[model samples]
Target chain A: MNVVDARQAVTRAHREEWARVVAALTRRFGDLDIAEEAAAEAFATAVERWPDDGVPPNPGAWLTTTASRRAIDRIRRENRRDDKQREAQLCYDSPPEPLGAIDDERLRLIFTCCHPALAMPTRVALTLRMVGGLTVAEIARAFLVQETAMGQRITRAKAKIKAARIPYRVPSAADLPGRVSGVLAVLFLVFNEGYLTTGPDTDPVRQDLTAEAIRLTRLVRDLLPGDGEVAGLLALMLLTEARRAARVSAGGELVTLAEQDRGAWDAALIAEGHRLVRERLAAGTAPGRYQILAAINAVHTCVRDVRDTDWSQVVALYDQLVRLDPSPVVALNRAIAVAELDGPEVALAAVDRLEPDLAGYRAYHATRADLLRRLGRSQESRAAYDSAIVLAGNTAETAYLTRRRDQLG
Target chain B: MQYLISVIHDDSTLATPDEMAAIDVFNDRLQAAGHWVFAGGLAGPDSATVIDNRGAEPLFTDGPFLESKEHLIGFWIIEAPDLDVALTLAAEGSKHCNRKVEVRPFR
Candidate 1:
């Protein structure tokens, strides 16, 4: 290939191996900002030099080694003029080895980014930017927030880490359980954003976001075995994600669970989720929220059709979940299950309790409208639909609500 | 070893009656397991009176410790073998309460 073509190939290769390379480099260089800078510099250096010297046999390893050297060089250069740079210089000079040698380092990075010390929004932004490799603008776009706002969030998070002197090292074995759960919560939120996209232009089914969440969860599970919650979360996400294809119609209208085609669900993910849920249950420990949610999803996935779903069992699980993690969101979900098991009127009352907390949440209003419509309260249903339409983020959901309102009219 | 698992969050965010009853069910499980020592959901932080009796006349203050977004929501004293077991129970409390739970050994 020509020089231009070779450079293009190198860039592609770098993008493909970006996570592994950056992760290994981050272990060597403790600072995320410095590690990222070094990794970029290494990739750029390769694009310029690889055309003449020929591509390395193991490009990821070469990039990692090169990034470590570049980090050391930068530190040394800074140290020449400043005494304070000496500590950083020492850290870079004897950087940690690659993945096999530093099993816990990447997990530490994940935990640090998702640290409970930081706010929820900060945790999500930091995780996506640092681990998911999403650009600031992309993350801003994903959340429907201004780019400047997202940038400030990330900057503030980094500052907090530095100011608090939060070490980049992995947590001790004693602290691992708590820290790991925090990391999983971050990833799960990221996936939820994709799975339930409320953006005006984009489809509600965010396949890319869902896929990334699944991949990260799998990576964490592999690194830490016998982590029931990790497996539970992965299973939960997969089971939910399996229904993506049938979540909405080709016309971009929302399809309720009962109407969706069972065949369209991803059977592979379903099988994997089932296996994990079973394994976690067999561990003989109390089920966490993730495990409970996974079990709930498994119940849904295992049913032959939506009508066949064990609504009573689902209601029981929701009862347990509401007890386990009593969020307004969980209450709204439980209300839906109650609607199926009991009647729309009972569910409507249950949903009413959530109105104070979920006033701004579109799904809450949308579900309320459905329950009202089922009870033949046409005017009330239309009003509820109107609220949902106003709060709805995505075009698909807005359109779906609009149709429901029209039907009521 | 008994450790105290203290629920700490904004006083305004206290769980409602239904939610509190759910927590009662969780404590029931713990009690059945023989890990529960004593647990109670506290009233608002302002209801707490801090007394400093070092002076001739006792000085009194209206609220709980720490002036911040967080407050002492509630707590449970449970017996566990070590920090690991204590933390596991703390995690359970945090999850069940849907809030932060600080696990500290009883002095």
Candidate 2:
């Protein structure tokens, strides 16, 4: 193989087999540091040797074997000879199962990474690194965190998992339903980080985090196909992703729903999103927060014109969502729809009540600013816009708010 | 693997009769399941003393090492294969004792 082709194959193999190699190593060696380092070394070796030797027929198995050797070598070099023989016996594990077994291994790695014992951010960082096969630098860049600090967080998390003996197994049946939501939460956070990435210097939209989140969520969905929330999450991501093209203007400012060009939205993603939403609707099961939210997005995407949108259906979905999650954020979103249906005066009352809870939330301020502007209270609206612009983290959102505030003149 | 499930409380209130009954049942279940290793409640932190001996002259303190509103009132060291089992047991223990619990792995 040519050098460039060999390098591309190595990259593809790293993406495909990193998690499997790491998961299998972790199960055998029972050490995150050892498993992660060994997998990385194996990939590095592939880069060095694949150009001359050609790619292996079964890259996953090849990577796993190389990684196991690296791990065992490290064990011997570290003078842990007492564990060497015993660990070698573990290396002679049952023959690798088909795809189903690989899925289970990935599931275990994911559940372990998303364990509730670890803090939320720790779970996100670890999941990205271990399960998503992302580098520490890449993850840190996505979240706008210092690489050193993010590295330490992942290090401490791995140590805790090892010391605490966080098992490399999925939650039991009873725990699965509740715990899957936690896993979904981490994935959703990754998706949102990509969707409306923060900071001035960073890209307003981080396709990497969003794409990774969708990829990982799809993996979870496949692993737990019967999960409604998982389906709902996937649907929600697809619907949101469908609008990605039109969400930002040519100037890189966020285009509100009312202003985005309908022509720009991806038809295929919208169709897929609509199908998932419809499947859940036909299932006759009571919807969860994500399902209801996806339904709401489906409503928004189903329409070709902003003026043709069904305000009542959107508001109804938000009402259903409020029952599931009575957070101020949901209430604030509901109020936005309320503005369209019940007019700004009524929506303003609801938005104002959420102020105590969402005082610092940029969207809350932006919503309030829009409602006040509709009521012809330009001065109050301008002030609300100011608060929103200041609090806005995403460059696109900030620019959008700035343009809106200027337009109040 | 073993987890130290520390029972935490904000007040000096001892377990009520009902709570003690529940704890007994929970402890019995843990024993039956082979998850029970050791479990006990402690007196108030006022009964504890702290001694620092790292210095040349050992210093003695009359109270707990750190005085805080919430303190460890009891604990259970339960043996389990992994954290999931340990966490579920800790949750049950917390419910039985009617107090918050924290789990930490022993090195």
Candidate 3:
């Protein structure tokens, strides 16, 4: 194969097999750091050699075998005293299961990474590195931490896992229900990191991270098909991602949701997401936070245009969301929806009530500014816009707030 | 895996009679479930002694392992398939003992 095609093949394999390869090595060597390093090295070798030698038929298996061999060598060299024990451990490993059967290795890796004993940030970082197939640099950039710090954090987390003897297995069925939230929270954070771009010039969409989160969520959904919340989370992501393209304009400026070109949204994604939400709702299980959010987005996508949207239904979903989530951000969103259903005065009152809770949140000020401007309180609107501009991290958001403040003049 | 469940209690207080009865029932449950290995209550920290042998000769001292108002008044060593099982048992142990329990798996 040509170099271009070879590179694309390698990238695809990397996305599909990184977790599997690393997991295999981890199971064999019983060391996460070594497992990750060996898997990465195999991938690097593939990038260099695949152009000359054609891509293997079973790339995942090839990577896993190569990584396992490297791990065996490393273990032998590092612990000569325990060589016999290591060898005995490898000798009894179960043969690879058929390709069609469920691969529990990736699930085990996810559970181990998101173990509650580890700190929340450490869980997110470790999950991104191992399960998401993201480089330390990519993860560091995503989280806005120094590369070395992120690297150290990952190293420390791995050491903690080994030191604390966190088992490399999926939780038992009884424990599974409680642990799902932690895993879902990490996946959502990864998606949000991709969805919420920090700078104007950076690509509005980090498709790799978003796609990775979706893929992982799909795996989780398959593992827990009976779970309505898992389906709801996948639907929520798809629906939010469907509007990603429309969230920006031709010149890299922020497009308010009310003014976004709905036609630009992905129709296929909307359809799939709407279907999932309906199926989950029809399950008639008690709705979760994600299901509630997905139902809200489903309402937004159902209408032909923003003005035709059902504001009361949107407000009602937000109300449900606030009861379940009860966070300042949800309150801010509910107030914005209230503006469309009720009047600016009522929305303004709602926004003011959240000031104590959402004092540092940029969206709170931005939403208040919009409500104030609608109420003909130009001076207060300008002041609110100034706070939003100061708090805004992205150039596009700051520019949008500046323009709104200027318009109030 | 073997796990150590340490029941932490203030030295100023002792277990009530009802708590002692609950703990007896809990211990029997652990024994019946095949999770009990060994367990014991410790003397107060003030009556403890420590010995250090890293030096050229042994050094004897009259204090607990570490100085603190709350100390491990009792502990249980239980075998379990995994941390979840150990934690569950530890929760019941704490409820019976009427004190906070700290659980750590043996490395």
Candidate 4:
């Protein structure tokens, strides 16, 4: 390759290796902002020199080493007058003795980004920014928010981390279980953003988000062996992701579960998900929220076809889920499941009970409309669909409801 | 080393007696593992006493050193290999009581 091609390759490598470099540097430096700055500087230096010198055999390791050295140099220069700076310099100049054990730097970074001290929205923004390696503009666009607003959210999250003195280290064995839930929640949120795009195109934008979430969950499961919930979460994501291919139609319309093609689902992920859930269940522990949710997904994936789905078992799982986590959303899901398993009239009753709390949620109205349509209440169903259309944030979902309304007509 | 696994939280929202008994069961487990040093729930922060030794004469206070919305409800000093192990034990303590546990190294 020519010099220009080599330089382009070097630039691409730097961008690709940025996350790994940042994670390793953060582990060494124990400061997210400094690690980020040093890693960026290392990448800039690599861009200027790597093309001329040729790419290193191990680019990521080289970037990590260079970033650590850069961080040490910057700290020494800035803290020349402070005594603690001398100690920090000595500590950095001689790196810790390399232990050949597998370090969970990326998982630690994820936990730090999803620290409970930060607000949930801020946590999502920071996780995407630091761990997912998405830019402010990308995240802002994905969430349909302003770039400045998203940028400020990340800045405030980082500031909170510093002020709270949130440890950069991974949680202890006992704390790991609780902490895992928060990390999973952040990853799931990221995946949902991409899996259900609210944009005008009416199609999912970044399937990579769902893939990344599964990857991160797998990392967590590996780091904490015998963590059933972690395994369950990974299984849950896999089972849900397995259906992604059939979630929308050729015309980019949302397809309900009963309408999706089971043949198009990723069988490998479904098999792996079922295996994990079975293993966890056999361990003789009471199921947590993740485990229960995974079990529900497992049931959904087990059917020969959507019509073969055991709606009764699904309703039972939703019952367990509501008992475990009494969220409005859970109740909403249970109502739909109940409608499928029992009668539309019973489901309509459950929907009526939920209306006081779920008046603002678009899905509640859409679900009510579906149940009403099934019960042959055409006028009520149309009114409910109209209400859902007004509250619907995503264009595709609104279109799906509109189609359902037309079908009722 | 005997480490203090301080269970800090608001006293007003303290666990019930049955919950406290459950915490004792956890403490028993820690004892069986030979890590439990001592554990007890404290009264409200208003019952605390603080001594200030900065001046010529040491000043004494009737209540806690700092006034805050969330006060240290209780503490446990346990023996463990390191901070990591101590933190794990502290986390169990927090889980049993459904509150936060701050594992501070005793000087």
Candidate 5:
């Protein structure tokens, strides 16, 4: 292979195999920091050597073996402690077994990283780092945090896991529901960090983050195919991502769902997402938050025009979602649907009640502005729009809210 | 795994006779289920004292470690396989004691 082809092969291998190699090493060493470091060193070696010697036939296995050997070497050199000696022996003696088609090692790593004992932010950082194979710098950049802060957060989380003796395994069937939700929440939050960008004048779509979330979700679903909520979450993400192409106009302006061309939507993703939701619903499992949200999105996809949208069905799904997860954000979304079904006057009352909880949220102010404008309360609408404009982060949202305020004047 | 179920309550409060009876019944249930390790109730926080030894000489002080309306009134060290079991037992304990309970696993 040419130098460029070798580099491309290594990059592809890193993307596909980072988690597997790290997970295998972690399973052997029983230490996340060591495993991660070893895996990173393996990749660095690959970057330097692959261009000279070309990529291996089974790159994942090659990386796993390389990382494991490196870990053994490091363990031997670091200490003569009993535990270190035992770990080094294990790493040196164990042979690389072929992983199952489902890759349970990666699933175990996911569950461990998303353990309930860890704080939620730690869970997100760990998931992004260990499972998504994102660099600390990349994750920090994505979240708009300082690299040192992000690095310290991940280090503290790993220390907590070790100090607390959090087990490295998938939860039992009884504990699966609670534990799996933590994992799913991390994945969804990562996607949202990408999907709902608040950066000024930047590309709103974060295809990399969203794609990674979906990829990890698929891995989790394959491991737990019978899990309705998993299917529901994947379906929700896929359905939401299907509109990536149409959510923004060619001029980089925000396109409301009503104005976006349906032709720009990804039909394959929509179909797959709809099928997953339908299958999960048809299985007669009680609908969870993701299921309800996916059903709501499925309703949106059913109609060509926004006017043809089934507002009643959307409102009913939101009602169910509010029951499932009564967060302020969900309540805000439900209010929007309530406006569609009951009219802006009633929706305004609902929004007002949510003020104590959501007053600082940009979407809350934006929603209130829209409702006020619909009610023909131009003065109140302008004030609400002003608050929204001040709170808005991105140029698209600020521009849109500014236009609304100017129109009211 | 083992967990401590701390029953927190107002420092000056005391359980009624009815509440004590309910707690006894809940204790019997825990023992029967083989989840019970040990249980005890503390005197009001007024009887507590604090000791600080970071200086050259240990200094003894009279007062609870924390000045607050609430204190750890009682606690139970229970043995269970995992957090779920410990939390379920804690829920039962909370209902029986008629008090808020906090559950934490022994590290």
Candidate 6:
């Protein structure tokens, strides 16, 4: 194969086989650090050899075998410990195993990576690296952190998992609900990070990451077909993704829902999202955070024009969500909906009560700026906009806030 | 695997009679399930002393090693297969003792 073809083949192999190879090795070796490093080494080897020898017939199998050998070698070199040595000896040259329909290995890998024992940020980084097969540099770039610090974060998390003996299997039925939500939270964070990928502290819109988040969520949804929140999260991502193109202007400023061209949204994604939301509604069970949020988004996407949007239905959904989650952020979002149904005076009263809780939050300032501007309090609105612009992380958001502040005349 | 579940309290306040009864029940359950290794309620940090012998002259200090509002009031070492089991037990332990608890695995 030529160099370009070989490189393309290697990239494809890395994307497709990285998780499987890591999962299989993790099962065999029982160490995430070892499994991750070995899989990376295997891919590096593939890069070196595939160009000369051509791609293997079963690239997944080839990568798994190569990773297994490397893992055993690592065990032999660094470990004089009897237990590890025995495991290495037993795993050496083990035949490749078949994966089940949902692939228990990958599920177990994800659950372990997103284990509740780890902090949320750590869980996101670990999930991206182990489950999404993102390199440390890519992950750091996406999140806007130093590569070394990000590497240490992953390393420390792995060490903690091993040290704490965090189980490497999916949670039992009793634990599934809580554990699934934790996994979904990590996935949502990744999706949001990608969706709003640009900010002073982040990179420009990383659609690739949003796509990865959707794919992983889809995998989880398939694995737990009966889960409402899983389906809800997938639906939420799809619906939000549908408007991504119109959400940003040609000048790279954020386009508010009122200003976005409704026709520019992806109809197919919106359709699929609505279907899932409807399905959840039919499930008859009280919805959770994601489901409620999905329902809210559905209410928005259903309208061809923002003027035709159903504000009361949106407010009702937010009321349900407020009951489920009384967080300041949720309260802020509800107030935004309240502004649509009630006037700025009523929404401002509710938002002002949240000031102590949301003093440093950027969205809080932005919302206040909008509400104050609507109330004709231009000076206060300008000050609020200034706080928001200073706190805004993305360049696009900052640009949007700056324009609003400058338009006070 | 073993975990140390340390009960934390902000004062020298000991467990109430009802709490003690609940803890006794929990201990019996742990023993029945083969999860109990050892457990005890401490005498509060007021009874603790800091001892350092590595220095040429042995050093001694009054009270706990660190002065803090919250202090470890009790601890239980339980055997389990993994963190999940240990956490469940610790969570129950916290409920029985009616105080916050921290679970740390032994190396």
In terms of TM-score, which candidate is strongest? 2
- The TM-scores of chain A alone, one per candidate, are 0.88, 0.94, 0.92, 0.87, 0.92, 0.91
In every candidate, what fraction of the native interface contacts is reproduced? 0.00, 0.93, 0.33, 0.00, 0.07, 0.93
Question: How accurate locally, in lDDT, is each candidate?
Answer: 0.80, 0.90, 0.85, 0.78, 0.85, 0.89
- Cα lDDT of model 4 by residue, A119-189, tens digit: 88888888777766667897887777999999988887776555444556667555666887888888778
DockQ of 6: 0.60
Q: Give the interface RMSD values of the models in order.
A: 11.1, 4.3, 4.6, 7.4, 6.9, 5.2
- Top DockQ model: 2
Q: What is the TM-score of each candidate against the true structure?
A: 0.73, 0.94, 0.86, 0.73, 0.85, 0.92
Stretch of 10 with least lDDT, candidate 2 chain B? B80-89
**Candidate 1 lDDT tens digits, A1-409:** 3798778768676545666666676666656666767877888889888888888888878888888899889877877788665574344332232334236555666777887667988988887777666778988988879999998898877765654434465566667778888888888988988888867778677877788788778878877877888999999999999998888899988777888898999999999999999998799998989999999999999987788889999999999999989899999999999988889999999999898899999999999999999999988899999999988487767877898799884
Residue by residue across A173-205, what tens digits does model 3's lDDT show? Answer: 667778888899999988876777665456655
DockQ head-to-head 1 vs 3, winner? 3
lDDT of 2 by residue, B19-40 (tens): 9999999999999999999999
> Lowest-lDDT window of 10 residues in candidate 1 chain B?
B80-89
Number of clashing pairs per prediction, in order: 0, 0, 0, 0, 0, 4
* Residue lDDT tens for model 5, B1-107: 67899999964659999999999999999999999999999998888889989999999889898889888999999987555466678999999999999987786
Ordered from best to worst DockQ, the candidate numbers read 2, 6, 3, 5, 4, 1
- Residue-by-residue lDDT tens digits, candidate 6, A1-409: 8988989998998777787889899888888999999999999999999999999999999999999999989887776666775564344442332333344788889999999889999999999999889999989888878999999999999999887888777777778889999999999999998888745645457798899999899878878889999999999999999999998899889899999999999999999999999999999999999999999999999999998999999999999988999999999999999999998999999999999999999999999999999999999999999998877576778888999999996
Better of 2 and 4 by DockQ: 2
Q: How much is the lDDT of residue A258 in candidate 3?
A: 88
Worst lDDT 10-window in candidate 2 chain A: A93-102
* Candidate 1 global lDDT: 0.80
| Model 5, CA-based lDDT | 0.85
